[model samples]
Target: MELRSMRYFVAVAEAGTVSEAVKRVHVTQPALSRQIRLLERELRVTLFDRREGRLELSAAGRGFLPVVRDVLHRADAATAAAESLAAGRLVHLTIAASPTTLTDVVAPFLATFGPQDPLPTVQESSGPEALDRLRRGADLAIVSQQPPALWSTRTLAVLPLWAYVPRDHPWAGHETVDLDELAGQPLVVLDPTFRPRQLLDQALAEGGQALADPVECGNAQVAQALAAAGRGIAVVSDDPRFDLHGLRITQPGGDHLSITLHAAWDPGHHAAASLSALAERLEIFCRTRYPHP
Candidate 1:
């Protein structure tokens, strides 16, 4: 019903008990229960059922939680966007994209929102190449194509990496691949200085193989073009388009390279809470479209 009611409901679901939710929301258990009751009455359905003093979402509640989370998340983003607009303080979100991905993937992803809307005091940083931004206090970083975890922060979320290549590449038909199969193939990779190199190296080493003379490029668009040009195979994500003609992309058969995309924040920073909220929104945005585990 009310925004605060939804918030309280979410708290109860997360805490797994009305008493704990009361403690978390800083309200009395009776009052929290009353609000929940009101919400159920308005919706014409009960959201939770108590079992052994623990609260569990009923079937309806299970379906409802994500909607509630999405609403709360959007509210949080709206508030952050408003504050960002007022402060005009360059609340920098340094999102690192792979070179080709910058033009082909990340740029397009960011474009879903109006170019001028909320204008998120941002500095678009490319991943793999832009890992430094994270090291030097950039508020948001893309770490999926990089090592397991590039920075140690109070809050960090790592997403599984994906490899998007042309449809004609040798491995295009298979669902996955063994890392060694990529050895000796022409490899179009992020520059050696980029964070993706670490992930690449680790994946290959574990499989006892390595790329033979990798050629580096600037962004996701260029990488795919390069791969299509027969320069080498370009590794990228689903967001980046790799549909160039005359090339095929194949996921390795068994072993695969799964990069971790991380959005993190140091605990000491004053805006850590804000950054964490932003991270959650970005991740949810990525998840809704990609839906990977």
Candidate 2:
């Protein structure tokens, strides 16, 4: 039988009378009665015992009541889930970013969302990997440089590259150092897998300069720590948290080297509204804290 007939059967079963159920279901008594009769005929069992101008559930109707209620409840739940998905309120947003970006940008951006709002899941990966995860259905990605043509992006901030030097180092006294000045220095560098490191390598190659047997780390914090210990100068993003008294940060070649942070997402994602909201909040935070000059 149709779900509609099942619902009519339930209403009549619950209300215990045809007239009462018809009023509750907003259907004519004849239509409700006809559907109930059809359901009973289809099931090949009497659903109700009619006597003394009142209706009572038969044994079979009592057995079927709970089953029909369960089906309707499950169907309603499925419909609600679909609606939630359409409204961008159901899925857990996945944001992929580099470790530095995760610490500096993504974490803070997430804090701006209300406690009641759905929290996003953070995925730390290299720049290319972050975009790759986005391509593979991640809800958002934070990366350096512009996104590919297929993805939509919002530029969050333009961050200058800085040289972290030990207090006793000769370059510590200088506010900035030329690109040539970094040549042959014992430097602490992030792993070449990182996009920032690749950009720095490209610039150094173009200028015909290179670090002298650099110390390598997977992330900037470790590189900064190594620099603080006087192992070597560290090249890192200009985050104030990484600035220590013993470690002075200097711009490289007076802002000749810098990177722009961007939030990217597939425009065709089903949760476009959620992605847009996240990007807007991140952009606002970046503008307030790291506004480009």
Candidate 3:
């Protein structure tokens, strides 16, 4: 019949006495006994053998114990799943980030959650695509520029631009290079759709220099690889994961150019609360990992 009645039956069967079952089920002995009797009546089968002041399971009770246990287990599991979903703990979040941030920022943030917690799905794209993913129902988007004024956004980190020069290059000997000095140097840059490229272009414009025919790569690691191979200098965010073994990282001199990263989500989305919480965590993680000067 009812789950409560089934629970009472199981408790009494396991405890071997109505008195013992009451202690476990936290009901009066009479109330528990009534439930067991009601259950047996409903099933039209004798559930327990009571003799010599001890109770033992009857054939019917033995057969039903396992079934009742399974039912209770399933019910409990279903309840827990429902509660988790309502709390937003079980939602499968989709996070969109540029490839460099996915490695340098999102990966480390994920590491702190431990293996037991469900991980968010990551979508690696350039800034524009990442933002587009957010608009199309991604839970969060991590990008180098703030989202448009209408979107909900949290500033995560501000990173300075760094130049990766081939180890054999003359600039490798210096700690930093000026923007003017890099003028006319073939540059390995992220695709124009990415924010870092826009920032680099703006900085170059301000410095009265320009990259006439830069080698464009889809992501930061590729740009680094191209620079390492001496194709051009890679200008990117100061992400440590970019392999610098065959390159020297140089900071831009004077009014160093920087990019601000933000986590953005659509405010009207159903997961807005969860996404906002995720954005907050990302901001805290980025601040701890890359503290602003």
Highest TM-score model number: 2
Per-model lDDT: 0.61, 0.77, 0.76
Residue pairs in candidate 3 whose N, alpha carbon or C atoms collide under 3 angstroms: none
Identify the runs in model 3 with alpha carbons over 4 angstroms from their true place. Answer: 1-90, 115-118, 238-253, 269-271
How much is 60 displaced in model 2, in angstroms?
50
Q: How accurate locally is residue 120 in candidate 2, as Cα lDDT from 0 to 100?
A: 75
Judge candidate 2 at residue 71 and give its lDDT: 77
Better of 2 and 3 by TM-score: 2
Model 1 ranges with Cα > 4 A deviation: 1-118, 124-138, 144-166, 238-255, 266-271
Q: 243, model 1: CA deviation in Å?
A: 1.1
What's model 2's overall lDDT? Answer: 0.77
**lDDT ranking, best first:** 2, 3, 1
Tell how far residue 9 is off in model 2, in angstroms: 43
Candidate 2 lDDT for residue 76 = 51
Candidate 2 local lDDT, 1-293, one digit each (tens):
67888889989988989999998889999999999998889999998999897789999989998888767755654564576677658446678988888898778777877754665788988767889876544678888878888898888888767777766677667766666667567888888887667777877887776656888998788888888887887788846434543222233454556778988987766567767877887888898977666
Model 1, position 103: C-alpha lDDT score: 46
Clash count of each predicted structure: 28, 0, 0
* Backbone clash pairs in model 2 (N, Cα, C under 3 Å; residues 3+ apart or in different chains), count: 0
lDDT of 3 by residue, 74-177 (tens): 67545645755786574466789877788888888988875445557898777678887754446678877668987899998887777887666786677666
